[model samples]
Target: MAITCGLVVANIYYNQPLLAEIGRTFRLSESEVSLVATITQVGYTLGLLFVVPLGDKRERKSLILVLILAAALCMAGAASAPSFVILAAASLCIGIFSAVPQLLMPMAASLASDEERGRVVGKVMSGLLIGILLSRTISGYVGAHFGWRTMFWAGAAVMVLLTGILAQMLPRNQPNFQGSYGGLLKSLVTLTRDLPVLRRSALVGTCMFAGFSAFWTTLVFFLESDTYRYGSDVAGLFGLIGATGAFAASFAGKSADRKGPDFGINLGILLFVGAYVLLAFGGYYLVGLVVSVVILDVGQQMTHISNQARIFSLLPEARSRLNTVYMTAAFLGASLGSLSGAWAWTHFHWPGVCGVGLAFGGMAYLLNRFYGRTASVIAPAL
Candidate 1:
């Protein structure tokens, strides 16, 4: 599950480290180059809404395998793209199929006991975060050395390997669901409208991802500017530094198990608020960049794990659908953040980008505080 999910999630980030190269190769301005990030994110959001929910209705194992295969084909197509439009289209396809990871998260939670679900989901998420955070470094280094096209090919190869592994190793899941196709869509609307579990979880998760997206999407631009000329290798190293978020995932997951997702999430929100303030100050210096990266990732991933723990606990029988809501919101924020960050980079440079991060962090902190108060009253009943 970990390997499978990792490969899927990595698709979103592999292009980040190579953004500068893509811009140069395609004769693009900063924001235009940013279209690479924005387009991929938009694709992922679409997949989250459409592709991920299929896991609730289908045999998850088969569904994941098929999506993995399709994503691999997309990556291969991206590698051979003859024009920017083709590349962007192929990126969207990759995002659409990468919904496999969303399925894997809920699957891990479902397979575990309620008390253990957070930790199990965290363990799975650790791999997903690692792939997300590290792919930039790997893609950056490799993209710098070999070319961006080769990075897609590499992703395709990994998809093939994971697909074979998933096919052979994953056990078949029993079918358990209610309603026809129309009813399924209706229930989705009902779930979105009535479920506090989905509402707060999706909103907070989205804000945290926005904070994460704002920083990372602009980071490479920072590195390439006059302040630093270290290029993609250095940009890649930040991904490794940011892997601290994976460790925080386990910590947050375990904390959610011990306390509850509500408390855990608030703590994460506070952490992000603090980290971004530090980033506001540190945005200019290299050492400050490293420090901010570590804290930022840890805070972001912690909130994410907490949100998953909360939402998955809400519906044991429909974890996949819940995940679809959570991730759809997250990817939407990410999509907006990528485009906004690019615009920030163009107009305000690092400071403008910092405003986006601060705003998102502030929004998350306020919303979670409000929700936490409500949750306190809800908890006595729980």
Candidate 2:
């Protein structure tokens, strides 16, 4: 399941490192090309709000298989697109259907015992994060050696394989919600309104992912700049360095299981702040960039695992709905971050990007400090 999650989620990120290549192909401005990332995230947010919620109301295995197949077709479409508009439209479809991972996570939580839930979630999320990191690495190399179209074709093939494997191996999860789809959608509002932990987790996740997205979306441009003059292969290699954070996911999960999730959450925010501080000097030195990548990824994963553990524990029956609320907000933040990162890069360059990231980290820290206590208290009981 973890591997499958990682593979599907990887589709959304392959375009990041290839942004320069794609832009060159279409003769697009940096701002126009950046919309590929932003719109993909927007499509993901829509999926979270609409498709992921169906996890609770449908047979999960079948749902996952169907979505994976759809995503594969979308990837094919992206690979064949002759114009930027066609590619962008295909990217949106890919984002919408690649949400199979979100469905898998809640299903994993449902299967695990409370005592081991965090650990289980951590393991699966490690795969997801590693996929996020490695997708860039793989795509960067492939897109550089072959054309960008080849990378999307490769992703489509992988998704087809995953679809077959998951179809055979995945367990059937009976629908928990018996209501109509309309009611299921309506209930999302009620869940958000009544659950303080959901609200806080969603807010914190939003800010953290915004910072994360900002860094990644602008990184290719920064690397291509005169200051660095690095290629996509080097840009992709950073993903390997960032994989250090995959280790933090398991540790954070175990830590949350042993202690309360609050400790890990707080620690994550501090690391986020420190990461940006280091990244502020990244343009000057390679070491600064490497160290910042490790710190930033670790911080982001830690916060993510902790927030998820807390939210999953809140509603046993409503795990998918809770995830829907949390992830929708997170991806919405990602969309905003990608847009803002492109803008900052265009107008102010690397330092401006770092400033935006720092502001986002600061906002997350402040939100947690102010509301975390109340949310924590209400979480376990919800």
TM-score of each: 0.96, 0.97
**Candidate 1 ranges beyond 4 A from true positions:** 371-382
- For 85-125, candidate 1 gives per-residue lDDT tens digits of 88899988888888888878877887899889889999999
For candidate 2, give the lDDT of residue 16: 95
lDDT of 2 by residue, 89-204 (tens): 99999999999889999999999999999999999999999999999999889988998999999999999998888878898998788888998998888888778878888999
Candidate 2: the clashing residue pairs are: none
Give lDDT per model, in order: 0.83, 0.91
Error of 1 at 139 (Å): 0.2
Residue 378 miss distance in model 1 (angstroms): 13
